[model samples]
Target: MPKQVVPEGARRRRRPTRQGTVLSEELIVRTALRLLREHGGAGLTARRLGLALGADASTLYRYFTGMDDLTRAIGDELMGRALDGWTATGEWRADLRALGLAVHSSYLAHPQAAVLTASRVTGRPREIAVDETILGILRGTGLPDGTAVLIYHAFIDQSLAFAALDAGALALTDEARTGDEGVWATTYARLPAASHPHIAATARLLTDRMPHSAYPAVLEMLLEHTAAQVAGLNRSQH
Candidate 1:
């Protein structure tokens, strides 16, 4: 006789581990995030996650189909964190600025996880909720549906793109990151004005600013343009 396969739900309902730890999807995701933070992306293996959770490696499958599934959950988890304790300020521009900053900061807080999952579309509840909130914010500005959607896409993508880029740099080893920064200070800052007048003139400012993420500045520019569009619409209506 062939052995029977257990249903996923049944497996999930199995008794707790000998350590008395009850494994849930939330527990697994949080543990995976912690592992990613401590060990980087390459360290987020099933064996490692299982060890961290104090359960057998195969037991994780009771909740998730595989690591890919877990990756989506982890990404959604970051979005959830961004929404936690967040409330809209009623001013569309201010609300959007806060939302973008919240998402960017959440990703940077988990650089390893961001590097792995930033570019993904999780389609999970938290991700969907964030999308809805952003679109609602844009629409509340009295913008047309199509215009609201176009700006929505650009805004969210810009936030994630910058987060991933900065997170990648943040994930680098301390020595490697410092060396990269040193090139700007030693080489760009020392460029001769005669040969490279433009760079030489701005060298000090470049060295000061280049090491930081430009997301905040760019976000403001985008919002400025958006505010202009909203003002234009209001002017025409009156």
Candidate 2:
């Protein structure tokens, strides 16, 4: 058989097509997460996301109202992950620790989103679930109703602020990152031996302590206060 002739014009006009999974809202959010992880929060935009997904930027609106809405959804997803399998066992300290660490670790996973979502209290279902869980644990601790709510707010706000600061510091530019952290190191190194004897003496213990190590101590202190309040109520009952 004779070979068929190929047209040079047709060959020149042909372009290869990309083959892969189609882009969807969940897939887009997941891709945004990767971008956030790699480039930080400012990097998350419809254009960038579309480029990542190989789709038109407008397609994202089909799933989300806007970037703000999309970010909220991402936050909700994070909260859900953090609350996975959480249960109250009527042990206040253990329950509080679990919730605090879960929220902290969740935001740590996506530092950029943590900054965006941390300040905004979305009364959305997952967030409400978290609130309910904490309230349930605090109530189960045998504290009065008002006392339980107060402790819940105090603990939650404390945890959220610390987590946000930790995430934000990590996301800073190299110059900013070095400067912010280096200040603490520099501050102590220059502390006078005579004028600031106390600061000079304990500077080693203060400087060498990691945020992780110190945070739990602070949390324990807060829990201690909560425990004291609960203990007072118990004593009064007796």
Candidate 3:
């Protein structure tokens, strides 16, 4: 028997799912984020995503090549949100601080997704845009190319590294997370003065400071050092 031919357009066309949710790359990434938030990293398989979208698992491949590709898209979506309404205010220090905080907070807001993607190099549009913005801000400091690149690398990696650390703690189960937090108050705060003089003396301070993310303080220090470097360069040019 002769085979019947299907038109190219018909083959490419996809109908809306039972829930009337249209599947696009953006939609998939957004839905994937919500699933990650609700179920954590391990629960974000294609089958689950399909169920959440009210569609067949195979339907996702129509948008993304595979799960890895989709994961990268999710990472890019986070970056896009980080920069969504952010604009540079022409002050390099203030701008860098704002950008760093924005990126860090964005990751912390999705701790589960950050666990999966914090270390990934998406090389997608949003990630590339972030890199470009960072380098541009660094260059605007009038620093040499090597220095600008060095600071840019350090700044970005530091932001992600801290975000990943904080997110990991945030991603823990409720009881585990609470137990971890309790250590500062129960164990560290109760350290014996004779055995550990410094820690014992400063236990109260440690307990107060340890629970918060250190990204902001460290970011301020980096910005301050960068500003000093810019000043030295300016002095040398005179």
Provide the overall lDDT of each model, using Cα atoms, as 2-decimal numbers.
Answer: 0.90, 0.75, 0.88
Ranking by TM-score, best first?
A: 1, 3, 2
- Looking at candidate 3, the ten consecutive residues that score lowest on lDDT are 1-10
> Which ranges of candidate 1 are over 4 A from the true structure?
1-12
TM-score of 1: 0.94
Question: Would you give me the overall lDDT of model 3?
Answer: 0.88
Clashes of each: 0, 0, 0
The TM-score leader among the candidates is: 1
lDDT at 103, model 2: 83
Measured with C-alpha atoms, the lDDT of residue 49 in candidate 2 is: 84
**Tens digits of lDDT, candidate 3, 1-238:** 3233343344343677889866667777989999999999889999999999888888777777678888888888888788885788999998999999999999999999998988999999999999999999999889999999999989999999998999999999989988888898899888888998999999999888988899999999999989999999999999
Task: Write down the RMSD of candidate 3 (Cα, Å).
Answer: 4.5
User: What is the per-residue lDDT of model 2 for residues 1-238, given as tens digits with 9 covering 90 to 100?
Assistant: 3233234333221332132556455676688888888877888898988778766677576566678877877777777778995665666799898788888778878888788777777666788888888898888878889988898898788777877888887778879977866655689756998999987887776666642324567788888898899889889999
The pairs that clash in candidate 1 are none
Ranked by lDDT from best down, the candidates are: 1, 3, 2
